[model samples]
Each structure stands twice: as C-alpha cells, then as structure tokens.
Target: MEGKTVFVDGALPGESVLMQYSSVRGKFDEGYVKEVLSRSADRVKPPCEFFEICGGCSLQHMSSEAQIEFKQSILKEHFEHFGNVQPETWLEPLQLDTLGYRKKARLGIRFVTKKDSCLVGFREKRSNFLAEIESCAVLMPKVSELIVPLRNLIGSMDAKQSTPQIELAAGDDALAFVVRHMEPLSEQDKEKWLNFAEENDIHLYFQPKGPDTVHKVWPNDNNDRLHYQLPDFDVELAFHPMDFTQVNTSVNRAMVSLAIDLLELNGEERVLDLFCGLGNFTIPLAKKSKAVIGVEGVDSMVKRGYENAKRNNLENVDFYQADLQQDFSEKEWAKEGFDKILIDPPRSGALDVVQYLPKFGASRVVYVSCNPSTLARDAGVLKEQGYRLVKAGVMDMFPHTAHVESIAVFERNN
Candidate 1:
C-alpha cells in the first residue's frame, strides 16, 4: 500500500474496509469491499436489490447529497488542474428525482436454456453476462415494470434466442419499446407482442435488422414519435424511438432554463446553438431572442430541427447542417455575429469549434458538458481567447453514477 495506489470499489473516504482484489496491475490494484470495519456518514444502503451486481449504477452506495458533492469536487478539481482558473460564482447544484428518473435505456436480452427462460436487464458488473433482474430502480416506473413482462414475453416467443436487446424511450404521456430481433418473428410471436402492448398500454416496435428497420407494431397509428415538453418555454419536441433525447426529463428542463438564464438573452440579441439536436435549445432561445441559428452535424437531426420549428410556429429560428470540427467561417450562418452562443457538444468536447468562438463575435457562451476533463481543456482555450469563466456548477443529471454533467458560462473580456 505504501509503494502503489489501490482503487477500491465499495470503500468510501475515511473508512477502513477489508477488500478483495479483483485485478492487479503494475501501477495500481483494483478491489471491492468485502467487509467494512469503519463507515462514513455518507454511506447508505443502496435501495435497488440488484445494485450489488448490476453495472447500471456505480455510486448507489453514496448518499444523494454526498454524490452531488463528489461530482462538484471533481468539476472543481478539473477546472483548477486543467484550466488553471475558477468561476467567479459557483451555482447551486441542479437536481431532481434520485430514482426513477431515467427515461431511456438499452437493456440486454439473454435466453438461458439452463433456466428455460429469458433474462432482461443490464449487464453484470465487471462482466459481459446479463444480470438477472426483474426491476430497475433508475428507470421510469412504467419501463421498470416491463422488465419481467418483457422477459416472459420473449420466453414465449419462437425467436427468444434471436432477440438480443430492447430499447426503451418514454415521454410525458407515452412509452415505447423497440425489440431488436436477429431472426424473423412468427405471426404468432407478433400477435403475442401486440397483445402485450395492448394490455400494458404501451407502444411496441420491432427491429429485425438495423435502426432504420425499426417500425411500430402495435395500435397501427400514424404517429410513431414520442415527445417531451419544456413547459417553461412553451416548447414541445417530438422524436423517433431511435433519436437521441435526454434521459432525465426534469434535469434536462432545469438545465435548459439555467443555460438560457446564464445567457441573459434580450429580445434584440441573436443566438447561435452548436450541436443543437432537434432544436432543444434553439427553439427556446428563439422565444426569448430576436433570431436563433441551430447547427448540427447529422442530416436527419437538421431535418428534425426544422420540423420542430415549424410545429412550434417559430419563424425566428433556422437550422443548418455543418461539421463543427471543420472550418465553417465561410458559411453564411457562421459569418454573422451572435450576441450569445450555447454549446452542447458530445463527450469529445468542442475544441475544434471553441477555438473559433472569438471569431463569431459572441459576447457570451454557455457550455453544457458531460465530460469534465474536456470541458476544462476547452475552458483553458477560451481563457486564452479573452473569455472569462463567470459561473459554473454540476447538474445531477445522472444521480447514482460517476458521470458529471456540468454547465459553465463565460463572458467575453471586452
């Protein structure tokens, strides 16, 4: 212990515990708590029965407040270490439901001949095998309740062994499940699935090939999309089952409100939103600003953004398609000066785009980041470009996991 570092899975800070080593390395060792001789006040008994084995959640052992504090410390450390700067104001941590908040998930499906049944849930921790779980604590109650019924439904199907996964998506008033089957489903299997959907009052879909092959199987309705609303902005977004949407509805709503407030947009200001999928922030910004431009890399999402704008009757917003990683200064949208900018890039961060933010002549920038390290690195770049980090804080978008979702606001140092 004196010569090397040890990473314990279940042990908390300031606690003595007996641990069993699972993996040994030259630089460090990995282990889990076998016995806790001493405990911290922050430690709590995980509410989920499958938390011990399920890989879905890692920080369930820590109290909810402690988890938020831990994430905040991580963000602070990243800012100090990578960016060499700190925000002037540390915002209050944004949080919502600690459990039953996740509205989307990709659950594993496994047919075990030994048990003569099918298993449906997340994979086991540190293993490739699926965990045998009947209910999930983090998923929405409607989706969690479908686990056992989904298992039984697959078990009764002729293609049980071929169905490998189920994709879940939920909205304010609708829930949908997409069954990914490797083989063809018999007419009887289809009927069974339809009956299950009808009884559960949920939409059912089938994916015999790829994501493009996913099609609704129940109710035979023309509408194949699920929607969520940002009631504060009077905006509603509709998306297909395969489309990427925020998993926590409340957190997303709160995050959007925070980002918009940080921008301090006036009716005369023009705003630009980068990586704006389905006009999540752009349309809302349009409601408060004079004009808004939404740019995305994917073609389908660009179309979806336009479709949503039309649905909301928002003529002040426009959607554009561009690879942010490349130079886009020549484009008409990029040439215009923006009063404020909102960036919600992927995990890789927006280094390629952030480096050029100063050229856009934006007075303010609000960045929503999923990765602290990348955010910190980009913050350093922004500092060099004469933008001062003003306010920053973590959001409990993912409650019981190590994932850190944070937002930072920067004002141009004019």
Candidate 2:
C-alpha cells in the first residue's frame, strides 16, 4: 500500500490489523478488518451476539465514552474544515443510557423458506439482506422482547412473504407496532395479531399501503397519538406513530433542556422555533418566553403542534406551516421579530432557514443539528450574516453509532 488514504471498517485508531480490500477508488481505498494483529485500548467486546452481522449498532466494540469523544472530534473537524471557524468555548458532551434507549425504528421483515422462519431485524452490514436476529440490545426493552414473538407471529401468517417492514413507535407508556404488508392479511392472521396485541398490552396497526393507509386494529380506542413528557417544563407533546421524533427518550429530554438552556430565554422575550414538529421545543419555550411561534413544513405536524399546545393548556404558543427550504419573508409571521430563535432541522440542515435569520433580527440563535458537515456549512453562512459562533457541544443521541447530534449557539456581533 502506498501513501494513499484507506478507509477501513471494523478497525480502530492506534491499532494494527490485517485488511481485505472491498473497493478501490482513485483518491482513497476502502477495506475491512480481516484480522487484528493489535487491538486498541478503547476497543471492547460487543455485548450483542448479533453485533458481527447486524447493522443496528456499528460502534458496539468501542466504549461509550470513546464513541462520544470520536463524535466530538468529528464535529470539531467539520467546524474547522467547512466553517473555517470554531466556537469560543466547547461544552461538555451530553450523555445518557447508551443501550436500550432506541424507542422507534423501522425493522426489516423477511421470511426464509429454508429456515422456515421470518427474519425480523436490521439489514446485514454493507448488504441489503436482512440479518437473522432474535433480540436487539439498543432498542427499548419492551420492543426488544417482542422480536422473537413477532418473528413467530409473522412466520405463522399466510402474508409473511408480503410483509416487508415493521415499524415500532414507543412512548413513555404505550408501544405501537405498525406492520407494512403488501397483500391483504387473512382474517385468521389478523386475529393472531389482535390476540398478541391484547396479550402484550400493546397497540397494533396495519399499513397495507402508504403512510396514509396506516390504521389501528386493536383496543378500538380513537386515541391514536403517543405522548412523551418534558418534566422540566411540565409539558407533554403528543405525536403520531409515523411522525419524526428523537429515538432516545431520555437523551431527548436532556437535549431539549440543553437547547433551552443555551437559548437563555427571559420572561419578556418572544421566541421562534424553526422546524418545530409537534411543539417539542415550542411549548417549553412558551413557558419561559412571552410568546412562541412554531413553524414546520408539514401541515399535520402544525395541527399536532396546536393539539399539543391545547393539551398542555398553553395559550401563548402558535403553530404555522411553511416550507423552510424556501423564502417566506413577506409572510405575516416572518414580519414579527423574535428576541431568540431555536432550530432543530433534519440531517439536510437548514441553510435556507439560516439565511433568513438576519431578516428575523434574532439576537441569539440555538441550532441543533444531526449532521456536523451541514452544520459547519451553515455556520459559515451565519458568520457572513454577522453572527459569531459562541459555544457548541455534541449530544449522544444515537449511541454506539457514527451519527453526530450536536448543538451550537450563535450570537449577533455588536
């Protein structure tokens, strides 16, 4: 091997290992660890038996603290490389329970005629084939225990081959399983699922088509929403099973608190929450601010935001629907200035929304990002608009993985 860069999987820094090349590129090469001649001190035995094959948790071999440090370094590198700037002070990484924290996930479903069983888990590493797994260490305990039973339930059904996915959405008290089937389930098969739901005391839903076709089958309770509480603000936010939410409940609570603390809201200030889905942060902001306006891209989420605001008995919060990727400067809500702003955008980041910050005249901005690369790029844009990167830190949202979830604060330069 020459001096060209090589991207190795299953290999750690300060370790020597035998590698098998998977692919070759003009700039860099890619490979995996065939055998480790030397091991890093940070490497540890993966707890899950399926860690070797299952794609669910990638960094299980690394210590939890080491994983967070690695993510922090990645964020730091992104800021220096893309933004050409760094925060004046780095905040300590926010952490919580690393395992048994994932509350929502879309598990792949496949029936193997050879094994005479349905495989229910994530895909195999670097492959599209589903991994044969009985339990997941990262998923919530209640959902993890259902894997074997769910496999049996699907294997015994006539529509096993037609069921391609099973999505789990768990709240503080309720757990839901949304089975996506390509064919109609036989009445007997439906009865089995209903009995299982009743026995497990969980909600069950069927999705024969798209997201719109998803409907509950058990309990017949008109209440389809799942709620999680922010005890810090005495606020509870209700969301649909398919809506976007943080997977780690405990980490989410801590992350929301951290974001609000960074904003430094006063009782007299008005706050703007961008990409606010279902009033997760908006409601909490309203509790500390004079008024809060939440803007989201989806209409359903806006309605859900209103629903959550009313559910929590908060009248100072308002929800609005608008495409955050496009300009809405002339919109009535945009005309009203905000004293502080909080943004929690998807992995794509919020370049379009960040560009409009100067127009809003917010003195302080708190940005929560899942992608450090995009966040760094947006940081550059904010710098050009007369904002200084004040402080930043990473949060261990998706532990045992390379995904980086971080928060940054920007203050307008005087």
TM-score winner? 2
Residue pairs clashing, model 1: none
TM-score for every candidate vs. truth? 0.98, 0.99
Report the poorest 10 consecutive residues by lDDT, candidate 1.
217-226
Per-candidate RMSD, Å? 1.0, 0.8
Candidate 2: worst-modelled 10 consecutive residues by lDDT: 323-332
lDDT string, candidate 1, 244-319, tens digits: 8989999999999989999998789989999998988988899999999999999999999998999899999999
Against the unseen true structure, what C-alpha lDDT does each candidate score?
0.92, 0.92
Instruction: Return the TM-score for candidate 2, rounded to 2 decimals.
Output: 0.99
User: Which stretches of model 2 miss by more than 4 angstroms?
Assistant: none
Question: Per-residue error at 204 for model 1, in Å?
Answer: 1.4
